[model samples]
Structure formats: structure tokens, C-alpha cells
Target: MCARIIRSLLVVCASLAVAANASAGQVQVAVAANFTAPMQAIASEFEKDTGHSVQASYGATGQFYAQISNGAPFEVFLSADDSTPAKLEKEGQSVEGSRFTYAIGKLVLWSPKEGVVDDKGAVLEKGDFKHLSIANPKAAPYGLAATQTLDKLGLSDTLKGKIVEGQNITQALQFVSTGNAELGLVALSQVYKDGQITAGSVWVVPEAMYQPIRQDALILKKGADNPAAEALVEYLKGPKAAEIIKAYGYTL
Candidate 1:
């Protein structure tokens, strides 16, 4: 009876060891949609440096906030706007003093078809398109920028009912790409990346049109001591990651 018990105990210990080994080398990240492409590039570099695997979930800022609050097991959050992380820190979901601006987002007007969005400011005011797409301003930073740009350019009222709102920037881009909408307001990173332009006419929105979209990162309290989380932040601030982000058309 004693010999049989010892064997069972050894088997249980081996299973636990395997589970620990699998998780010990990985990090969990929640990233905003706007930074998806660049984050993938950064992840490769981070893994190369620290031998740590990274798993990231991407979505709208508000949607991600909901996920984090519901106790989704994420170690870090890279927000498209600084406010979400600030709110998380204040709400005790993330470590205070760990939130910092990591990148600046740029807004753009783009279309997948020719002559859909003239780079000139006239198209918005011209009001010829049947459908214009923007991410939901309530949940997306890029959506907020799109609204602000219209207000600044005195085109909001003229373009109001013509708008089709998407749940997130990714969806917003899809609305235009799928030919459901003629034009859209989307993140610069998605339009011009990998040394190529998406199939579209793009107008890089002027920085002066809205508040600076200062993107921020936070180390969630669940992972304050995670080695993978620490290494990721360091890698993001390094040269290779910065180059990748810049290539995606975001400002440092």
C-alpha cells in the first residue's frame, strides 16, 4: 500500500512541474487594436531577447477595459489612448506609477477604392459619399480623433447622418475595405506599414486637428513581478521596436 501511494504522488508532482514550466516562460498582454501590427513585431524582438513567449489580446479600449475588469488573465495592457490605463490604475486593476505613454497615435482618413477620399479637405465638406465610417467614439480613441477632426474642420454637422460607426477601429477599417462604406477614419499604422500602403487613398490627419493621442502601457497588478512583462516594456523602448512602430507610421 505504501509503495502504490508513493508512485501516485510522483505522477502528480510531474504534472504540476510541467504546468509550471510552461507558464513560467510566458507573458500575457492585452493590446489595443490600433497597435496590433507593431506589437506583433515587438513581440518577436522581445522573445528573442528574454526567451519569453508573449500572448496578446487586441481590441477596442473600452472593450478591453471590460475584459480586464472581469478578471481576464492579462499581465499588461497597451492602450491606444492614455486615459484607459490611467482609469485602470485609479480603479486598482493595474499598478500605479507603472502607467506611462509608450507611443503616439496618428489618425488618418482612408478609402480602399480610388477617388473615394480625396486627400484634400474638400471630400468631407463635399459630402458626396453615401457612407462614411468611423469607429465608435464612445469606445475608441481613433473614433474620438475622427470626431474632433470634423469639428475642427467644420464638417461634423454636414457629415453627421452619413456616418456608419463600427465597434472598433479594426471593424471601422473593414467597413471601408469591404465596400460597405466609401471612406473611413482609421489609425495610420494600419494604412501604411511593412513599407507598403493599403489599397486606399489616404490623408494623414494633421496632428493639430485633435488632442495628441498619447498611447500608454500598464503592467497589470496581476503581473507586477512577471519577468516577461518587465522584458517587454524594456524591449518596446529599445531601438528595434521603435523602428518597427515608426515604420507603421506612428510618432515616437
Candidate 2:
């Protein structure tokens, strides 16, 4: 009788998965640049667990913010900073009571090879390198943090001409990885993943060097009942996702 009941439960669960998949609603997500890797993992895992599909667009947090404010139909937002998500909540762009931090990002001075940048966020200060890449400060949280770090060290004025701006942190990292730029300011996660491959040398910048990169996620006003969006967001805060976040060198 017990075995029969277990078989019936499995049948019911399979039927539910099929029904949920058949009726699954589509969700559009706007993710922060720094979160690309982890978000990809989360998206894959969420789909496997819930039998749902989601579409994502990634960009600089500020750029996404501009798009959202301009009527982009994003059903979820993963912000690179706390302020923007909080502001979106205030402006009613997101569902009330559905915002929270998903990760604490780590900024780094990254190069294609080791020894390119010695200790200190001082590599750009010398201005000898051919090119230094950073995300556009006006539209990327990591870029803004890079600028703030340069300013605090009194090097912004000198490095100003050597800088190349990318639309997002991922692009900025690409500039260095492709050797178009000798070095870049980037998020730590891009350099390493648990089971994936990457190449780079990175100095994880200390938190004191800049304000925290508190990445936040939320269900948008249109995504109040989006199971995929909610599941992905909730999954990120759970044990499986937390392990992946840490493995990529984020703090939490």
C-alpha cells in the first residue's frame, strides 16, 4: 500500500509539472552586468526545477534602470546597487514587498595575465599601459565604483585619458581578456567559476576601496504571479544558489 501511494504521488507530481509547463507564463528579466554568470546558472536551474521559461536581457544597472523607466517590459529586475531597486519599489515599477539583495559583488583589477597589475588599485595611476577598460561610469554601478576608487586615490585626473568605457562590466572585462585593453576594472565572478573555464589574473579589491556592490533582485509590477521569476529570485537566496554565488568569489 505504501509503495502504491509513493507511485501515485510520483504520477501526480509529474502531472503537475506538465500542467505547470503547459500554462507557464513568459517572463522578461533585466539583469545587472556583474550578475551574468550566476544569473545564467540560476535561470537554468529554475527552469529545471519548475518547468518554466524566462527571457533575460543584461546590461549596466543604470542602463537597465533607464530602460525600465522608459517603459521596457521587463517582468523582473536584478539591480547592481541597492538604491535603484529601492527607488523602483518607491516608484511602483516593482511589486511591493518583493525586493531583496541577492549577492554582494567584489570588484577587482583584472588582466589577461598575472603580474600585469601589482598590489594596490594603483596600476592605472602610472598611465603607462596602452589601454585601461572600465564600464561607463554613468550607466554601470561597477564603473561608478571604479571611478570612486580612482578618485579616492587621487588618480582619476591622470588616468582619465587612458580609460576606455564599456557599456557594461562584462564588456569591460572582455576588453581586457581580448587584450584590446591591458587591464580592466571588473567584477570578480567573471574571472572564475566552479566548473566553468576562464583566464585572468585578478586582485579582489577590498571593500574599503569603494562602497559595497549590493546587488538586488525583484519581481516587477507585471510579474506579481510569475512563478519562474519568483522561483529564480527565491532560489538565489537558498542553499544551492548561495553555494554557486560563493564559488564565483562573491561575498553574498
Candidate 3:
């Protein structure tokens, strides 16, 4: 009698497990390169907690916008700047009420070699570096911020010849990390972890130098009815995700 009861319990547990697996869903997410680390961590946690999986693609906001406009299969977008998502909403590409600010990004001038960048960002005026990397201002918001900072300091023309443009912020940072450029203006979150910079030297650009980097998230029209998309959106706004975002040096 005891063996029969145990077997029955095992059968019921197996059924429950099968049901859970059957209901699991997957959401395709297009994420800004700068938010790559935090989003990866959050996605892992979301899957574990909710039994849904996230398939994420990282790239520049402008590039993603162009792709989405061309009918890409992405269901959700985590943009580096709020304007892109807002523009998508205006264009009817994303769900109107699904937009919200997820994080505020900070721009940083960084170099892999210690002491290459000063705290006050005077390195630009010095003009001693061979190459200074920045993302394509036309495609990356952080690139725009970098240009604005140089403009505010009246160094844009002086540094114009030294500027090397990357396709995106990740590539911009790569230029610095790989010694293709001595330094780069990139997202703080890329090099920051555990409440501090991960390596090298950095100067956090003053917020006043450029417009606020209000990163926003939105569910695209394709994801309007997707349970995984909705769940991922709510998970991003929850405390666990907020903690991870903050830990990566972003403002909630």
C-alpha cells in the first residue's frame, strides 16, 4: 500500500512539472548595448522565477529602431535613450502604454590604462592621446553626449582629427579596450560593476554637459499579447531588476 501511494505522488508531481514546462514562453528582446550586463542578469533571474525565457539582442538604439521599422521580430525593446521608444510609440511600432523609464545612463571617458583619463576630463584639451574613440553620433546616444561634452568645453574642433567613430557604444569601448584608441567616451554601465568601475581609468561626465540619458523600455506591437513580454516588462520594474541596474551604476 505504501509503495502504491508513493508511486501515485510521483506521478502527480511529474504531471505538475510537465504542465509548468508546457506553459513556459519566450520573449524576444532588443536591448541597448550599454544595458547589456544588467539585462542579461535580469533575464536570467526572470527565467528562473517565472519559467519564461528571454532571447535578447544587443545593439545601438538607432540601429534597432531601423530594424524594428523594417519589421524585425523583436517583441520588447530596452532603449538607451527614452526618445527612441517614444518615437516608436508615435510611429505605432510599440504599444502606447507600455513605455517607461528603466534606467538613467551616465557617460564616461575611459581608458584601459590607469591614469590615462583624468577625473576632471582635462585629457581632451591636452590632445596628447593618439586616438579618442566615440560611437557614431548619428546612431548612438552616448556618442551624442560625448560630442555635446566636447562642444561645451569648446574642444570639438580641436579634437575632431583625433576622434575615431565606432558603430556603437560597445564598439567604441572596444576601441579603447583593444588599444585601437587610447580612450573612449562610453556608457558607464559597460565598465562598471558592483558599484565601481571594473578597470582602467574613467571620468564620469557631468550630467549638465548633456541632456539626461533617460533609458526607457517598451513592449513592441508584436508583443502586445505575449505573456512573456508582459512578465519581462513587469520584472524589469521590480526591485530585483532595480537593484541590478543600480549596481551597474545606473540611476533608477
Candidate 4:
């Protein structure tokens, strides 16, 4: 009787260990640079609410897309534009029909110097600044939006010589914040807090100036079988995640 009881206890312990190991597995995510802060916030809450952890790599969405196509081991992708995920799904790199818009982002022309940027973004027209930084239009969705806005305003040709391009939106913002550039076109969420600009002058570009930045999230083919990745994707669409995203100046 005693031997049977001990064997039953060992079996239960082994099963419990397996379950714990599965719950502790991490989800690997590739996130766009523009969504850096929000993704960090979301990842923290996700890890706390669920025992699953997330390891996130942040960079330009275009670069991530290229990496994914080349078989990057990311389980999830949070993009700065909806198109990239849709393209990935079409290419069969992402789980079929597993992509969805997580947030809508805003573009802003910003200057760290007080009064350097105006509400109407006339600074771009004035062209007084020595340098204007923007992300590489070919590699970043926000950069593409900035390029579109400049084209819409007929400043593309005029501003060509004065433009300095960064690899990603985060780098573009760094150029402005560090005074490497007098002004920059960057993500609004990076400079906003409590419905206001934080320590900078910002012109929130009108939506009509460029295409809407509909950010999307996708479950990659590598993560289709990962429970943690699927749970994180669902969490991003939940009420808690929406609140956090909205707090960062993003729209649902």
C-alpha cells in the first residue's frame, strides 16, 4: 500500500512540473519601433497577468517583414502598418487570418526647442531649420507617411537637401531630441502624455495629409502552435490592452 501511494505522488509531481514548464515558456515578438513604448507596457501587463513571458525585438516594420520572410524565429509581429501583416499573411509567412489591427497611430512634426515647431507645422514651409530628420521612407511606415505629407504639401523637392533620414522612427525622434536635427517627423505617441506634448513643441499632422496608419498584429507561422503567442495576441485585443494603447495617444 505504501509503495503504490509513493508512485502516485511521483507521477502527480511530474505532471505538475510539465505544466509549469509549459506555462513559463516565452513568446518571441518582433515589434515596430514606433510602437516601442506601448509594446513594452503591454508586455509587462501580459507577463504579470499570465505566467507566460514575452521577448520583444523592436525595429522598422519593413525590416522585420524582410526578416520574417527569411525565417526569423519570431512568434508574433506588431507592425506599424496594417499592410505588412496582410502581405505576410498572403505570402503564408503569417498564420492565415490571424492578423488584426491593434491600433491607429498619428504622425507629428516635433521640435525639442520651445516655439520651434508650430501647431500648423508652418516650420516645414519656412524651411529655417538647418536639418529636418525623418525615418527612411523605404523602411518605415511612419517615414512613408511623412513623405506623403511632404508631397501633399508640395515640399518634397524643396526639402530634399535639408532632410536627414534615420533608420527608424525611434532614431528619427532621437535626432530631434538630441538636437542633431532642428526638427523631425515622428510618431505622436512618442511625444505625448496625458493628452499633451511632453517637453516639446509638436504639430499633430492632420489625418487628411497622409494615409491612415493602421497598425496591425500578426501571429507568425513559427508561433502558430505556441500557446503563449496566441494568448498575447488575444490580450492585445482585450480591454486592458486597449486602455493602455489609448493612453499612449493611439486610437483603437
Writing each residue's lDDT as its tens digit, candidate 4 over 1-252 gives: 999999999999999978987767699999999989888988999988888999999999999988998889999999999999989898888888789999999999999878888889999999998899999999999999999999999999999998999999999999988889999999999998667788768899999999999999989999999999999999999998998899889999
What tens digits encode model 3's per-residue C-alpha lDDT throughout 103-196? 9999999998888889998888889988999999888999999999999999999999999999999999999989999989999999999978
Candidate 2, after superposition: displacement of residue 5 in Å?
18
Candidate 1 yields a Cα-based lDDT of 0.87
Name model 1 segments beyond 4 Å from true. Answer: 1-24, 194-196
TM per prediction: 0.87, 0.88, 0.98, 0.92
Worst 10 residues of 3 by lDDT: 121-130
Best TM-score goes to which candidate? 3
Who is ahead in TM-score, 2 or 4?
Answer: 4
Candidate 3 or 2, higher TM-score = 3
TM-score of 3: 0.98
Residues 43-113, candidate 1: write the lDDT tens digits: 98777766788998888998999889999899999998988898999899887677878899889889886
Report the number of the highest-lDDT candidate. 3
Candidate 2's C-alpha runs over 4 A off are: 1-18, 195-197
197 in model 3: Cα distance from truth in Å? Answer: 1.1
Query: What lDDT is reached at residue 214 by model 2?
Result: 92
Q: Ranking by lDDT, best first?
A: 3, 4, 1, 2
